[model samples]
Target chain A: MSAVLRVQDLSVAFHTRGGVVRALDRVGFSLGAGETMALVGESGSGKSVTAYAIMGLLEAAGRVTGGQAWLGETDLLAADLSRIRGRRVAMIFQNPRAALNPIRAVGAQIADVLRRHGGASRFNAGARAIEALRAVGIPDPARRAKAYPFELSGGMCQRVMIAIAVAANPELLIADEPTTGLDVTTQAVVMDLIQAMAARTGMATILITHDLALAAERAQRIAVMHAGHVVEEADTATLLAQPRHPYTARLIAATPTAAGSLDDLQSVPGGLPDLRRDDTPPCRYAARCERRLASCDGALSVRALAPGHQVACTNPLEAAA
Target chain B: MRAILLRLVGAIPTLFGVVLVTFLLTRVLPGDTATYFAGPTASPESIAQIRTSLGLDRPLPEQFWRYLVDLGHGDLGMSLTTGQPVKTELVNRLPASAELTLCGLLLAIGIAVPLGVLAAVRQGSLIDHACRVVATAGVSLPVFFTGLLLVYVFYFLLGWSPAPLGRLDAFASAPKQHTGFYLVDTLWAGDFETFRAAAAQIILPAGTLALFALAPIARITRASMLAVLGSEFIRTARASGLSGPTVVLTYALRNALLPVVTVLGMVFSFLLGANVLVEKVFAWPGIGSYAIEALIASDYAPVQGFVLTMAVLYVLLNLAIDLVNRAIDPRARRGA
Candidate 1:
């Protein structure tokens, strides 16, 4: 399948009072048409930063230093995103209620996006917004459209957010921890809604999440990140079954499976290296890797063990099962 | 609408409290109303008869009962100094003060809201710095001092204003009374010359009040806008590809308006109080001067009537603000 988004060597730096914090460093990933890829990591892992940079939604203090985010023919990092942001690529953020305008009606919010990118006229935007709401499986979407974000449940708000995101039928969608504050059942429902919408539109999805189990269940491919680097990338089955990188193995061990008890979970030891330090090592996970070698101090490179599995480490873990 | 009606009904007790406080406080003031009205060389018998005729011989509670009854009948008694009914005196003078306060407040909002929003949007820019300076200067300087400075610059030095006079210039006469707001009445009377003269006469005092009112309004707007700008919804709005102006003006500004409007209500009441000094400086014939003149002679009726009018106006203003707030914010409609 042809790729819809190909990000290369994306680096983002935030200028703070202390020093420049390299939030994302040479992070790269790609998604093919209709493909669902999850960028999974812990907090401060640059997953959301990469998403924001691609969407041109980074704060004033942060800027893309070096990167090329090619959305087909256009370089997203360089293009005027005002026209492309909601039209060609859209996003649904964490905290669905906070992500929506509190004072505006949910339907008006949807209509705003529809008119902006969906090519709906003023008179037709309201009706088209109701249709968009109905597409997300909202009950009585007509009345629900007039309801404010504060009036809706968290799951319903997420669904409204999804409706707004997919209003233009964009070619790419970035969901940045879209189910963070929702309940477990609502999480599944919202994730299912996103998957169903992506399938209907054939839009490429970049799901940024910290839940490894969620990534395993929903994403076809997964990219594991630590600090600011994409440390490993592979098909979800291969990565989960025979994780090559030690960090990926530790991540899998950290997850609570159906059969695994509380005592069976193993956490990855040590914290992420300070990205602000100028003398920090190239391989951010090497300091925490038990399999770290002297060579790990040198330049880190991606080593492909199988046809579709790649890991960035000097000493890799052998395939399990 | 029900909310407005409720608020109106609720305001009655507050107005009554104001009336009660004003009545008692005026009674406690130094110098005697009967003595002052009776004159210096009056005989003891004449003074006694005068006191009796003026209802001063009645006990406090009875006097209060009579006052309340008169108030229920829309009578504010009579001003000893002017020999006119206090209600009629207040009715004639209130419009000038109302016109001045309204003009000042409108001017302050028109300038400060945009200035504050711009300062927040282009934070740390020269415009922001200028707004800070303007706000600080407005807040620090006294209203009377600013009034005098304006009169000095525009009337004495620059020759742009009429003499720091009352409502009209020597050449222009008062227009027919429709709204009692000279700007409205002159326009209604098709007297462009008087309108221009009225505008000129009002410019200094209103500007003085506007300068004072704008400081807090601009500061609050800037603070509120800064907060709204940092919220997640703003980033969401930007991600949704709404135009920069739409996101800032419509989304950001509307969210910022609640606090700004709240501050506006406070600033308005403050402006009314500040109007007294401004009115005194400009020699304007408004209720502020009327009350101050009555207070000096210890003529209790006009002073009491003045406080009552202000209290009623404040209650009504608060109701107006509540309605405006409801219109601006739906959350407020739910009483949230």
Candidate 2:
């Protein structure tokens, strides 16, 4: 099946008082219709930036220097933000409470999207909002519809955010750290709700998160980003079982689940290079890589290791093959 | 509704405190009503007689008790300067002050809110810079100087304004008092000529007060709008694909209005206090000038009455603001 969304060579830079910081560089990924992909990374690894760029919701200082984000037939990067956003695509933000309009009723917020994009009539929007809330497993959704964001708990707020996101039933959904602040149980429930909805609607989803375990558990394919670059992309089980790039192997090693004991958890050596410098290397992880080779220089490009598996490093770990 | 009623009931003690403090503070001034009314050259015996007749010779507690009794009976006491009942003088003067203040407030909100929202939406643009300059100049200039400058320009230089001397021209007869507001009263009387005269006379003072009121309203609006626009919900609103205007006006502006409403209430009260200078400059017969005149003459009853009136007005204004705030912000309603 043709991919529902395909983002290619995306580069984003933030202009600040100090200098220009490249927030995202040459990030590329694709998700087929009804497929689930997780963009997993550490903080400041451009996972969230990539999502925002595709949604056309970057801050004033951040600009997309080069990119082509194709959502079906429309180029999301070039489309009018109003034309694509909330209609063809939607986003569920990290902090659900902060992501909602505090003063407005949560139901009204959902109804707003329905009316704005779903073409729901004003008279029936209220009922449809309650229906949306119910679909998210919110108890007493009719009564809860009248409640504002402040009145709800954190988990409930996330559910409301989910409800609002799926109200219009867009073709693609970008969930950026949707479960970061939620408890484990609530996180599972929220993720389950999203998965169920995506399954029912056949919508493609890009789950942006730093939780490697959660990504490995939920995603069909995983894209590991580091220092503003996607270093590895492969099937979730294959990537975790046989991580190709040294960075990906280190990430899997650092993750608590894959380690045999607490002592076995190995932190990645060194740090991500500062993107503000003019002499920054093309492969940001090169300086931190223990398996670096002399040829790991100049512009790095993605090379296929196996079908549906790619690594951006010249000296990727080839032990499994 | 219950919250509003509770707030109103709570205002009683606050008004009483104001009355007690004002009464004591006026008594502590260097001169008493007796000496001022008796004149500087009056005989000692005549001064004593005036003091006794005016009930100033009574003990402080007895005076306070009698004042409260008279207040309960709706008698604000007799003004020593004008020989009229304080309530009657206030009734005659309050509408002018209200008209001027209301006009100033409406004009300020009209100009400031839109300008503030525009500045915030187009932050760092030329319009934002211009708004900043306007806000700075408004807060920097004293109200009297601004009033005088306006009068000089509009009346003296441009010859576009009427004489800045009270609510109407001296030669024109006053309109019959129905509502006591000259603008409304003239319009009620179907005398467009008197309405035109009243409108022309009020322009400079109201304009001056509007400038004073605009700064805080605009600044608060801009700051609040900037904050609300930067919030995560604004991104949510934008991501929802609501049109830009809908997001700015419905989502951003509505949320921004809470602080703006608060500042508007404060600015209204501040303008009432600031009205003294504006009234004096234009020779308008408003309560601010009346209070000042009574203050200069050490006329105890009118001064006390003016303070009491102001205190009551403030309490009521606060209640109104609380209601408006509750209407706009669900959180405020829940907290209350």
Candidate 3:
């Protein structure tokens, strides 16, 4: 399958009160047709930055330093903000409440999206919007269409947002922490909804979240990010069965999986390296890695541990992986 | 609906309480109403007769009863100064004030809301800054000064003085005074020339008062809009990829309107009382200035009646704002 979306050598930085903060360092990944890829990382690890970079939702301050997010033929990273947002790319945010307009009826919001993307005419958009709402499993969608964002529960609002996102049915979907704040059951249902929708639509999806377990369950491939760099990428099964990179191992060990016993769990030590000082270039996970070696000083190169599995580390974990 | 009814029920005590205070305060002024009207040298027997007839000699409770009874009967006492029926003057005076207040409110809303929206949308830009400056000017300057400035420019320089006062020249010149409001009366008369002059006359004074009021309304609107724009739900609206205008109108303005509506209600009520200065400066016979004339003569009848009417109107205007707010936002109607 030709890559439905490709983000090559992407870097993003912000000029905050503190000198330049490298939010997203040279990172790269791709999602093939109907493929689900996860970019998992802790807060401030540039997980959202990467997702935003792909969605072109970066705020006025953050800038894409070097990137070419090729969505088939169109380079998303280089496209105008409005064009990328309203046409080819779509996103689902973490906070469903913050992702919708409080005043408008949910149906109106869906119709607006449909109209903007030319998915439906102004007159036809209303019916299409109701259809989209129904597609996302909202019951009595026609009646609910008149309800404002505040009238709907968080879960319903999230579904309404999904309806609007799927209205355009763009080739790519970036779900950044889309289920983070949701209750576990709600999270499962929302994720299942997205995955089910993606299966039916054959659209590529980039799920940016901190939950390794969730990524493992939802995504075909998982990309572990640490300090704004892609540390490891592999099929979910292979990566889970045999993880490479100390960061990836630490991540897998830290996740408290319900299916596994507590003894299998371990916590990552220290924290992400500060991305400021001129001396800030290195394996960001080096200080946190128990398997760190003296040679882990300069550029960490991508070494394939298995076919189609690339881990950026000086010494790739030779066990299981 | 019950909450609103409850609120309306609460407003009664408040209205009565405010009216009672105004009634007592007007009586408490150093000079006596009897003396002001009767002249200081009147005979003792005559004074007693006047007091008795005016119901002033009655005990405080008895007087309050009489006042309430008379009020219920739509009978404010006859004015000792004019000797004309108090209700007649009140009936005549109220329409002019009502017209001016109505026009001023329309003017304020028309200018304030759009400018406020512009400021919020273009925050930190020149338009926002400029609107801020204008708002500050509107709020700080006294209505009298604003009215005077307008009169000077429109009357002397630009030649747009408001229609002459008390005369309702347009209405009198037109065939009849069937509808008390000169504009309405004039328009009803089917004499376009008089109607045009009557409207033009109102414009200068009304605009001046509106300018004085515009700042606060604009500031409240802009601040509320800015706050709404940054809210989590607004971000959600954007994420849905609803185009910019829809996002702003649907998400931002609806939430912002509630507070702005509250401010507009208060401003409308305040303007009812404050238009006195504008009326005086423009030599327009609005209730504000008419009340001052009643104040000078110590005409207890019109004063009491006007105060009661105004208090009632203030509550009603606030209620109107609430209804409008509820109409615009159902979530608010649900108290969410």
Candidate 1 lDDT over residue span B228-271, tens digit each: 99999998888889889989988999999999998888999999
Query: Which of 1 and 3 is the better model by DockQ?
Result: 1
- Clash pairs detected, candidate 3: A98-B232, A98-B236, A99-B236, A100-B236, A100-B237, A101-B237, B154-B160, B163-B201
Clashing pairs in 1: none
Ranking by lDDT: 1, 2, 3
Quote the positional error of residue B258 for candidate 3 in Å: 2.3
Q: By summed lDDT, which 10 consecutive residues of candidate 3 chain A come out lowest? A: A79-88
How many clashes (backbone N, Cα, C below 3 Å) per candidate? 0, 0, 8
lDDT of 2 by residue, B1-336 (tens): 777788888888988999999999998988777888999899999999999998889999999999999999999998888989999999989999999998899889999999999999999999899889989999999999999999999999999998898988887888999988788899999999999888888878989999998888888999999999999999998988888888999899999999898888899999998898899999989999999999998888899999999988888888888888889999988897
**TM-score for the first chain of model 1?**
0.98
Task: Please list the residue runs of candidate 3 whose C-alpha ends up more than 4 Å from where it truly belongs after superposition.
Answer: A81-87, A276-278, A291-297, A300-307, A319-321, B1-7, B160-191
Error of 1 at A197 (Å): 1.1
Instruction: Write the residue-wise lDDT of candidate 1 on A238-309 in tens digits.
Output: 999888899999999999999989899998999988888998898998778899899999998888788768
Off by over 4 Å in 1: B40-45
**Evaluated with lDDT, which candidate comes out highest?**
1
Per-model TM values vs. the true structure = 0.98, 0.96, 0.92
Winner by TM-score between candidate 3 and candidate 1: 1
Report how far off residue A97 is in candidate 3 (Å).
Answer: 3.7
Q: Which ten residues in a row have the lowest lDDT in candidate 1 chain B?
A: B327-336
